[model samples]
Target chain A: MSGTAPEMGRRDGSFEREPARRVFASELRECRYQFKDGEDEKSPTFVLLPTGERSNRIFIVGTLTEKTRQGEQNIFYRGRVIDPTGTFFIMAGSYQPEAMQQLAKIETPAFVAVIGKPNLYQKPDGSYLASVRVEAITVVDKDTRDLWVLDTAAHTLDRVDALATSTSPDIVKAKEQYPSVDPAVYRKMAYDALAQIKM
Target chain B: MDYSEVTERISRKFSKSGKEIDRQKVEGKLRRLIDEFGVQPSEAERSVSNELAKEFNIPAAGSSGGTGAGAGGATEQKAIAQAQPGDWVTLEGKVVSLAAPASPAIAQSGIIADESGGIRFVVWAKSNALKMKEGAWYRIESAVVDEYKNIPNLKVHSGTTITEIEKTDPLIPEPSPIRDLRPGIGSVRAKVIQEWEVTHDRMLQSGLLGDETGTVKFVIWKEPGKEKLAVGTVYSVFYAQVDEYNERLSLNITTATIMQEEGDIVTATGGDVEIRGAIVHIAPGSGIIKRCPVPGCNRALSRQNYCPIHEIQPNFVYDLRIKGWLDDGEKTHNILLKRDVVEALTGINLDQAKEIAENNPLGMDEVFLQMRDKVLGRYVACKGREIENRLLVNTCERMHFESGEHAKLLNRAGGAP
Candidate 1:
């Protein structure tokens, strides 16, 4: 909307647009660093990338490998999206009604992009599990999916590159959170995803 | 919604501008804009509204957005293409890329894109409100915009609010071109011209690759003999890690790096080492150059012939340099011959160069031309390293290809260890 000089978007609205981060499905599930946003806030949880980066909002692209309606609300649209390396669990709620509708209309094995927040749950064994809170999901083309793969691969490599000397707080947290993650696996996932793309 | 439904929405928006336009006419305008002007339906709607407002002498609700640095209402959507530093902004974009911060104290950063373009934004670590999810459209508001390295950047601070909304049309960015290749995982098309033995301790295979843009040195670290880039073959290098060593960008063809041969590349797009070419072009400062007059700052005086630190005329000094191209029968390399190299090749020292400069009315121009004549047309094999795409010859000897010195020339390609 061209109106005046280039400036930050008008701050008139009460809502803010979140910046989405790209992460591989394999790395996302392994991430165990979950913390509250701003200490007192609840609802949206933060997951630290194994390489020490943190993000509440992440966008991922993959094939919608499976989907099902869970419980009474059918309200919970449970789905799994398979990337090059692993599959991500997506739970679409009433808040994501549009994404739910889109999910219902699209067939499985279709190229899909999902933008979601991280939701963490602790098991009885004390280990943590990370799944996605579907904020939005849409069927996309191969081109869009490949571009996503490229960006995600680049991001994953940045963390791997930084891991050698990263003693920063995020990296330290990541090391503590997912101590079992080889990081090599994530790098491989990124490369595999990129290889699938024609470019 | 169909075309008619979209047109009705356009008419309602226009009526708010206090302009009375027939609904049928507006629909006709939308149809023409879509069919003839090639405007998108949404864009045509906005165009029709603006046109009707202009016709009625009414102020357009959405005035043309200016591009200079300024502030605005946070709710206004600033397309990534229109975003600038200093704007209190709100907009929708897909998180396309993310970067690890140097310090966890600093906010995380990444590139956000829409159909307009992409931008880098930092979500303050302290904000902790949202670790933005990439690949989804968001409603970001109350964020401060700042310039990072001369480019406008968005900063999501404590007060910034992030709301994930329904996904919009996908925004797929163009892949990075060879010329735009920088340090990181870059995809490029290059030709392998030389390969070195694996390093003893690291087992890294180092070599050189060339593309039309320029030549780059590369190193690969993985299982030996799994991948071998043949000489003179062009290949698409993907996921290659680019790093800077000796202040030059080199690609690390590591375990993850992929290279598929396209064909035998005649371009000889390779590194600037072991160049065998003739001098076809000579730069202006090839002969009789001057150095800075300031003490302890002995930089060569630029074309302006002024010292950057002193901002004044530097004392003229005599130096001999042979600047020209070295064509390897396929590619031309910019080779610079320093004083010693010049003296060795042309049998002329700095004092002799000054004598020629003093006798000629054109001074350095006459000397530069004479130096070009002596070095031109002759092919020389030089062992050198490239600094910013220009070859700085450490050692050189004129080649005699037909004289059965093939082994000697090939040995030079190994470089002086």
Candidate 2:
């Protein structure tokens, strides 16, 4: 619902809607660092993107590979969405009842576009696992998926470009946090993601 | 109940055993068995938890509610950076900075950073927690991570504990480079490269600053006792607010303190870049177009002569521009050609384009069609500044093909061994 139209939406005076970032599943999986900007409890939780940006929400179009109803008392759905690069784990619970219902009804192997929050949880051993807390998931066409691939590739490469050129705070912080990740690697991933689309 | 909680609780069973286990993977395995294999939920949980315990060589918890590890449901002690939105984490960090409470319910709120990174923390007045002073170290236990504006902040409540500690050296954020400056208060030391004519009445001085990384345009507004910066002198500007305009980064130093420094900074010069590519596609709104006549609001008008902001303008100024895309094989760059570049590319100046639009039965679209036919798929080298993926083309010329290179390619294809 948040990403159906590209036009900017203002919810109210106090609540500013977080723009959903378009990133490849490959890049999204590597996102471990999470932060928030304001002090309000309702402020969105943003994940620090490796290429150099803070993403509160992510907009991705992928093929729904599998789905499973995970909960019993309060049912939630776990959906596996795969893009050109990798798989994005999606979890929709009672908190997002509509998304959960939508995920439950949708058949597998369908092209799906999702706009959701990036959620991360740390293991006791210190490694972090990332997934998307589904806000909205809609079945889409192959053309939409392809368009998203091209657009996401461009955005990913733009961030890769900013990693070196722009000294923006988020870029600087991303560089500091993810020092081992080479910017060229993301460039290659973007190219690889783009190659999946047939013009 | 969320299955994630069940999976996480099961995951805690292995935390003290020092065996690595993915919580989501456990949830996935459990879900697959129950949803796909049609096993009972209790059986699925038991089997999955047992499988993980056996794989890691730890004793299995008999039931889903049982805690296998000796830690026995204790909250995880974590670094400030590792804490997630919902987790109850015990963090040992110093009170780096404190701000005035936004509401009466909040007793204290500030940033707490360890060696990893910094996080904002808030102590609720209802919690009756001990007051924390800035620059002092405290061990905050059982604090919940609350998210706001996509950032994680610490919530100190009645359940949380705070203790003073003597820890040395938390990671202090360094003054970011000009390139690293986002839309926030930042400090930078750089040489004033060029000063521009003050365009606005409130603008005291505006110019370009350069350091080793890159150059940024800066504006010092007219304020009481504000000093003008001399060109070619290096100044250390502290707490300057960084803002963006038209995809380019600029600095506003109205409330900042400036001190001239001794070192001469070698500024990275030359913003012009030449990109050789084929004009892949011509975007809409190319060739002849009408713009709002209002100064500083030169937005293109709709087909009905309605400006988005100004609304229904009777008189509009004609402008010549080409919005297109250029693909240099690997990536496609958005290209914008203004009146000058459009004239050079299509041999149709603004006046000619206006005449064509006015006379043609097809109206303004005829000029667009002609321009598209002339430039689409044409191999050209455009020289300009690349800002936010758009190349503002200053100079444009058709790329010349080298005969020798073409001959070599032909030979390789026709006469190869």
> Number of clashes in every candidate structure?
44, 16
Candidate 2 off by > 4 Å = A1-199, B1-117, B120-142, B146-172, B176-274, B292-298, B313-318, B328-332, B349-361, B384-394, B407-415
Best by TM-score: 2
List fnat, each candidate. Answer: 0.00, 0.00
Write down the TM-score for model 2: 0.40
What DockQ values do the models have?
0.01, 0.02
Tens-place lDDT digits, model 1, residues B286-368: 77687665544545677667766656564655567766555442245667777888888767778888887778788777776
- Taken over the whole model, the C-alpha lDDT of each candidate is 0.63, 0.73
Candidate 1 Cα errors over 4 Å, as ranges: A1-9, A12-16, A42-44, A125-127, B1-417
Model 1, range A1-199, lDDT digits (tens) per residue?
1111011122322222334567888777777667765756544466777767877777777889899987784576888988876888888767777567767777888887676777778899998777887755666565445545555666677677677677888788777777776766665666666655543
Compared with the real two-chain complex, what DockQ does model 2 have?
0.02
* Ten residues in sequence with the least summed lDDT for candidate 1 chain B: B65-74
Sorted into a CAPRI-style docking class, model 2 comes out as incorrect
- Give lDDT tens digits, candidate 2, residues B103-161: 99899987776765567788988667779988899887656675665457688865466
